[model samples]
Target: MTTLSQSGGRRLIDLVPHIVLIVGVLIFAFPIYVTLIGSTWDSATIGRGNLPLTPGGEALVNYGQAWSESHGARASYTPVRVMLLNSLVMALTIALGKIAISIISAYAVAFFRFPFRMAFFWMIFITLMLPVEVRIIPTYKVVADLGLIDSYAGLTIPLIASATATLLFRQFFLTIPDELVEAAKIDGAGALRFFVDVVLPLSKTNIAALFVILFIYGWNQYLWPLLITNSADMETIVIGITKMIGTGEAANDWNLIMATTVLAMLPPIAVVVLMQRWFVKGLVDSEK
Candidate 1:
């Protein structure tokens, strides 16, 4: 009877956490739901304080107007298309670069021993404590000197080396058995060969998780891109959206702004949802 009661209590504890999580999810999701419904309405209707319950078949018209006005209103260029392509290029470059550098660096640190090894590791790890806001001005100057401003390189290169990626890969690498490396060496396998054949195969979950994270980070970067990009042609979706919202004394198109915001969020949401399985697997593997 005591054992049964203990199990019941433990189960109830677990149930409490799950119930709390569900409530939190709903609370966060409410704004997104509101925005989605608001995207289908015009400024006048939304201003009347009507909660976006149903789109009432106005979705098409709202989307069309938002796209046309924010983009090339007179057939010059589509803001959505341009900003999307810019975001894709920037996000993919940063994600791939961060992953590549992080994997190589983490593998080296984890497997090889050399002078200043701990120092080097600590130096990199310490970078994580410093926020990007502190270094933005210097970073901007460096990029400007390199003539990367208003270019893809300017947008992507500065974001390539992430301390977080290095830390994550290092933790994942530590979880790998040393015996595997020894076995590879016994078979006359070189470092590159071992990494390619053994380490990478086991790291799929970690890599997938890292890719999703870095992709989201790169995709959502706004301040850096805004500061560096002087041309509308070079602006990202977030910047374009901000421009739409307008400053004081300028009329803000709330309906179009909301519509664009919803559209801008689609790619990230799709990525998370699609890769959710891998993300869960990564977390589980990390715990193990």
Candidate 2:
């Protein structure tokens, strides 16, 4: 009996983590499932307050309307398609721009022994301590002065130069053997050529990892986009989704709102899922 009880206790211990994982998955997934089902119903069905547990047959109609029609009772009629495109552009631009700029900054800082290099790096590092909210007013003024508000450059440029990415690349660059640099120079490879061919290839993993992170960060931006883009056509999906759901005092088309929400979330999720392998590899390699 003692032996049997010990074996059973060990089995229970082994099963505990799986049980917790399953419960955690359910806890997170239930709301998404509800959102998915909610999107399939009609506005009347959703607006009634009691949400349905089952999927409705109106999935196609709801999604079609969401993709094409104006959301809420707002006078502006920005389609979800336009919002999706805007978000894609903002996310891609931010990711690529940050990586490009960070790579160059990291290369310069890591490879070159110039005066005030550390000072410049520390200046950037200091900016990371100041969150965007702290500098919002000044940033807006600059963007406004440049006449970039409601434009893609306005949405992306301010957010692209990441100290974090620069630090990551800088660290990774430091790990590169000095022999490679000497070898490249001996082989008559210029700085630009070595950077383009050697350093870039070595940094692919870090790039992919940073892309995933920056893409999501850009995609989920709410405050900046909200303040910058006055035009409905320029609004990103994250901000546009808010315009879909009416204020609590007003009537909201819950079905349409939920559908739009799902659509807004898909691209980031797809990006992370597709690039997960490279993302993981990049993160691991960058740590060295």
Best by TM-score: 2
- Residue-by-residue lDDT tens digits, candidate 2, 190-240: 989999999999988889999999999999999999999998889899887
Show pairs that collide, candidate 1.
71-79
Point to the candidate with the largest lDDT.
2
**Cα lDDT tens digits for candidate 1, 221-246:** 99899989998788788888877765
lDDT of 2: 0.88
Candidate 1's displacement at residue 27, Å, is 2.0
Name the lDDT of candidate 1. 0.82
Q: What do the candidate models score in CA lDDT, each in turn?
A: 0.82, 0.88
lDDT of 2 at 100: 93
Stretches of candidate 1 exceeding 4 Å from the true structure: 1-19, 68-78, 248-250, 286-288
